[model samples]
Target chain A: MTHSDPLTIAGKTFTSRLMLGTGKYHDFTVMRAALEASGTQIVTVAIRRVELKAPGHDGLLDALNLERYQLLPNTAGCRTAEEAVRVAKLARAATGVNWLKLEVIPDPKYLLPDPIGTLKAAEILVGEGFTVLPYIQPDAVLARALERVGCATVMPLASPIGSGRGLRTSELIRTVLDGAAVPVVVDAGLGVPSDAAQALELGADAALVNTAIAEARDPAAMAHAFALGVQAGRLSYLAGRMAERESASPSSPVAGVVRLPDPEIPA
Target chain B: MQVNGQPHPFTPGLTLHALLRELAIAPERVAIAVGDDFYPGGQAPDCELAEEDVVEIVRAIGGG
Candidate 1:
């Protein structure tokens, strides 16, 4: 892609369109290597209470190079707008970064985003000057509403979080893409590199991958594969594809007519 | 005082520095929220904790 084609979100430009989540990794070493292999400029982390009984265990800051990645803190465990706002504030205070990934999943079983709660939280966070990237179900109307409320990006899930189900909501996601004024990031449940590629091919600005890479036997290798897949899909989209038709067309010239004698042996 | 939603032993003039030290928590590794006020780790040394304060000490964890 050209310099002018970089993924721009909230007035900030990112060279790499792949975003990563720092979760479900075997260890920090693997996570670090995977992050490097993936070539992601934005990485997501969650804000959590320091367990009094378990101090020094949560060391995300120590493991990750802060300068290398733009940390997009997510409100993962929050079930309401108030809780998300609290988490957002805590995240901003800790990292001094205003960019947030707002997720309000009230349902524990399905883990689907609560659109009403998400919208409410987005409005509040955006008003507070946080560049919000909200995780949501694939709904075109909600995406437009979020854009109207000054969200930096809208992240629609392909399937349930960590399910590795790979674009179960493609039609809905396409609708969101068609209507989105801001960047559209297909997040969650991307099973493989092709899944990510398909999202990019379908005109999504980016894809956020976590489980598929992290849970793989070779996370770093899988990450590299995903990076290449994303680039390939993006290039294919730019190159454009041929139109499909019901009947097949001849590749060779049909004007050349050759008459061959019937074989006696075949008869 | 409630710290992280649990009642902890309260001291009259406990600074965040002393509390963190007592808890064996590194000040630079966490962010402190006392009621509605947010205090970064750098400000912990000067900020004192009140007896009836509700504090929340948080840090970054692995998540998507």
Candidate 2:
């Protein structure tokens, strides 16, 4: 279950099923090490203040060479559809990539996705020929609606963004996986390797993780661990599971075997 | 001189970059609009400030 297995989305074939986020890293060196260890082909990036021409303005883009990985720009801070659309356009113009991670969170405290705004933005962006990947709550109906709007993929959160609570909406997530036409990516709130494994076991097409790896004690090792966990989970899903039984029973009968002295029985 | 909708004491010879540092605004987050023209990040250093110079600095913020 190596990354040799192909994952196709929006006519693009990716070798890796794990999508990594480029945030909360101690530095670019560590980030690069973690990314290499994870073997992720698609990496998520947010458009923030990065001085383009300044001598030393913390150029994250320089570190993330575009040739190696496909950059998926995100509208992380946008709170409204209009704002998201504007930011998406700017990101496309700046980065030359039509791939967008549409995240419209209105509340600063919780950072929950604004469903109405997200829907509006997705409709517009899809019309504009953008590959939309909407990060949303684990709502089956919402996932279906997004698919209808021509979304490349539906990224349902395992929990709140960066909370690391792990798969809070397991039932709804399963519903999405069962009903979704496109790929179902378990995005955010994945605390450890076990969480990623559990999501893949529940039939998630992929998992997008950031804080769990970047904030780990050793980011590179954690990234490798996650890579293996994702592969194992997908393999387990492919290998069918057995149904659970309520009570245990012996295959041999216990009560009707008392007639062992019947030597006259026919062979 | 004013920048980003805030008042500032006028200096005879002040640059946009210096003014940005004074206001604690990162140059990357802001775009300067002055005299019906918009200047991107690179133009900030050479642009000098004058009396009654109406400069608008737009900063990136969370909005969808």
**Index of the highest-TM-score prediction:** 1
- lDDT for each residue of candidate 1 in A1-267, tens digit (9 for 90 to 100): 736679999998998989999999989999999999999999999888998887877589889999889999999999999999998988888877899999999999879999999999999999999999999999999999999999999999999999999989999999999957999999999999999989989889999998999999999999999998888778877878789899999988888668686586575
lDDT of 1 at A51: 87
Model 1: lDDT to the true structure: 0.90
**Candidate 1's error at A103, in angstroms?**
0.5
**Candidate 2 runs further than 4 Å off:** A2-4, A50-56, A249-267, B1-64
Off by over 4 Å in 1: A2-4, A255-259, A262-267
How much is B58 displaced in model 2, in angstroms?
10
- Model 1 vs. true fold: TM: 0.94
Chain A, candidate 1, TM-score of 0.94
Q: Clash pairs of candidate 2?
A: A78-B63, A78-B64, A79-B63, A79-B64, A80-B64, A81-B64, A84-B64
> Residue B28 deviation, candidate 1, in Å?
0.6
**Reference-based lDDT, residue A121, model 2:** 98
Query: Model 2 over residues A32-120: C-alpha lDDT tens digits?
Result: 99999999999887765423334234556667767988888899988899878876766664456799999998988878898889999
